[model samples]
Target: MVARSTCQPRRGFCFFMSAKRPQSGLLAGRAPTVSADAYHWRMRYQRIDLNLLVALDVLLAERNVTRAAERMHITQSAMSGVLARLRDHFGDQLLVPVGRTMQLTPRAESLVEPVRDIVLRVDSALGTQPDFDPATAQRHFVVIASDYVSRVMLAEVVRRVAAMAPGLTFDIRPTSEIMLGELEQGRADFLITPAHLTAADHPQEVLFDDTYKVLACLQHPDLAGGVTVEQYRSLGHVVYQNERGINPWFEQWYANQYGSTRRVEVITHSFTLIPRFIVGTRRITTIQTRLANQFAQSLAVQIFDPPMETPRLTEVLQWHRLRETDAAVQWVREQIVAGSHAMPPI
Candidate 1:
């Protein structure tokens, strides 16, 4: 005999409770009354396969069934079947066709962060070991940082760690507007960014602080006597603009401090390219002193004190709060901190 649940229908799987007959008893065939809430809660996950969560996470990230299948190392038809099952279980088409590409449905979009978080938590829980032996443990770390940070700090950290941990590998991704989102989603093991831009919820430590410096071509006539506030405003500027068309911290600060007084002649996405754009031109750019000093080594650019005082750029290393106690993460953090301390003074 079976008892029906009085609970309202929900989106996920449903289960019914059954009662077995007792041996030769009066109430043998009679079904027992079960608390609807208790039964529902107990059987909630019984019918659902936890593996589908992994599939759903990949499907939602790629949005394209073919691409998702490629990432999951399954055939396209198998991924289609998974998608069909997901749609049926969730009662929604998670990814729908939009013109030539697929677009995430509203429900799917809302689930992106939570699903990624769940998958990451599960991976971390299962993959973490009681002890981390960097020399023998095989691990790949993902770091998200700007080229400036990579050139100035992370490159050295990687070199230093590589000699000690031969089995360890690294994937350094460029910083973007969605960098914090990537960190939150656990795609990045570490995020090196400006202190002010770091997520407030995460644990972060200052890597280093650098003041701004003016960069110009060595042959520039106007800056021969050093730059003045009036000359700085009048000179053509080569500025750094990220791929997302967002201005860097100093550019934003300058605009706020002096309005639109400086004229932007060239805008490039790469910080390393800023000096190249200023060469042979009357243009000047304001960049971090550490990076300016680096470019001065190879490029024919001279660095000068900023015509006006600017806020110091404090680069910071950050990680997900959940990873604070991760042994491997802690080990890497220690190495990075030590590397930062060993950097040459600007």
Candidate 2:
């Protein structure tokens, strides 16, 4: 049987149908799908140049061929050639000129995230080392962690990294609702969070276990003879509030054991600022024991255990499961564990 071209266009491409009568056999009915898939797959590999992906990444970022060329340190004509090839391979005008600037088409917009992800994975694969040499490795590690971890663990971890890996640097970002997205997208290398909050699918290691302590001004009269549930509930409390969602383990536990009637007088995001706000005020807050002790040593604050039984805060260092085999990321996780162990146990 001969094949004839269809008048309709599908995804800017044509479809063909056999002129012969429909086959009664099941094998013949499914043959076209498999054949078409294999044909398109072969054609895709033949037309796609991996180098064009690099150019596409830059083009998406800059939205201009000249700017992309400048960043890639290539001639404008060379960049234009790459773009032309990409447009032909993709069967879409990826970028369209809109007066003074260029705009991404709908298809281009859809390709942005996946293309960036592929380019990032490729870069990471090429850049990863077989054996990380901490003594001389020049790398920057990005960490997303809560304020408590930043104060209690990250400071020591960063200090050790600086001493051992002098050429390396660390960027600590505050914990946010999008932290998991950042980790999955390779925007951040490590994440520090409590075990309850850590996703089970990721590669993670427990850094340390911590207990909570109630922090209050040293001269607060109500807290002189150990705090009880009644006193704690009556006093104003300070808690960290961020878009990352609530992390009120203590409050939740208290509500289960006691009741959900405690007053939250102040809500601030910074852990350091919590102490300043509580000083000379009747407001009290629950913090990790390590951080509370550190603050107690310098600030005029008193630390006490919570009245009811509370769960242990098991802090863990996590990375994307896909990056578990990467030597550099493994080394960073090891350094974090070592740093946590070296510190005095909380």
Candidate 3:
């Protein structure tokens, strides 16, 4: 005789196990027992293919068969076949066409977060090393940071690490509103941004704090002596605006305090470009002191203390919660923090 039981370790997942009864002596008519480890391995290997989960993740993310194929490095037809299998297994049309675009079915939408979590956990478990040797480790890290932070902090961090770990590489991407999502999805290893912008779910540390400064052309007649509050507000301004038209931290503060009293002469998407627009013009811009000083050294711009008190800008370094124990990640984070400490006082 055989005894059968079902196990469910996670929601939406079920496993069945069968054990034969012992036939003799003291153990007769008793069912054999299966260890938890044995049950897990049997369910994983015999019932599911992890590769399919990976494919499903990619498919849901892309939502387009051709693009999913391109991302997975498989043929379009192959991706379609994988989709068919996933649909059969899940008993739902995971991706259905809505006009020309594809949309996730309700079931597929429900699986996105859990599936990503499982994939990241598995990757972390398999990729963790007992120890890390920076000198010989071949590793690549992806960082998301604003251009201002990149220039003032991350540039120095990379330079220092290059000398210590020649085999390590970095891919730095610009900071965006979706940066936290990138970190959660394992697409970014580090995020350097203002403290307020960081996600509460992650672990973060204060990299540095900087004050705001008013920047104007060196030859601007009104600001030659010094800028007064009236002059600061009356002057045309060059400001930073992201692609999504969201204002920077200082801009938001300015709006609340002064409310459109200052005229914006120019709006740019780049933080570093703010000085370029200010130079050779009467326009003025408020920027972080660290970046403003760097620009003042080479450009014909004069830095002044803001006429009105502004909030301090605190830049922070954040990483995924799951990577807290990852040795390589911790090593790189230490290097970055050390670099921040070594920077000249603003």
Q: What is each predicted model's overall lDDT from 0 to 1?
A: 0.75, 0.70, 0.76
Deviation from native of the Cα of residue 159 in model 1, angstroms? 1.1
Q: Mind giving the per-residue lDDT tens digits that candidate 1 earns over 231-309?
A: 9989999999898899888988988998999988999988878898988989999999999999999999999998788
Q: Give the residue spans of candidate 1 off by over 4 A.
A: 1-46
> Which structure is stronger by lDDT: 2 or 3?
3
What are the runs in model 3 whose C-alpha is more than 4 Å off?
1-46
TM-score of 3: 0.84
- Tell me how candidate 1 scores on lDDT: 0.75
- Select the stronger candidate by lDDT from 1 and 2: 1
Ranking by lDDT: 3, 1, 2
Query: How much is 74 displaced in model 3, in angstroms?
Result: 2.8
Candidate 2: residue 141 Cα off by (Å): 1.1
lDDT of 3 by residue, 252-344 (tens): 999998898998889999998888788778899999999999998999998999888999999999987767777778889999999889889
Which residue pairs come into collision in candidate 2?
Answer: none
Q: Which pairs clash in the backbone of model 1? A: none
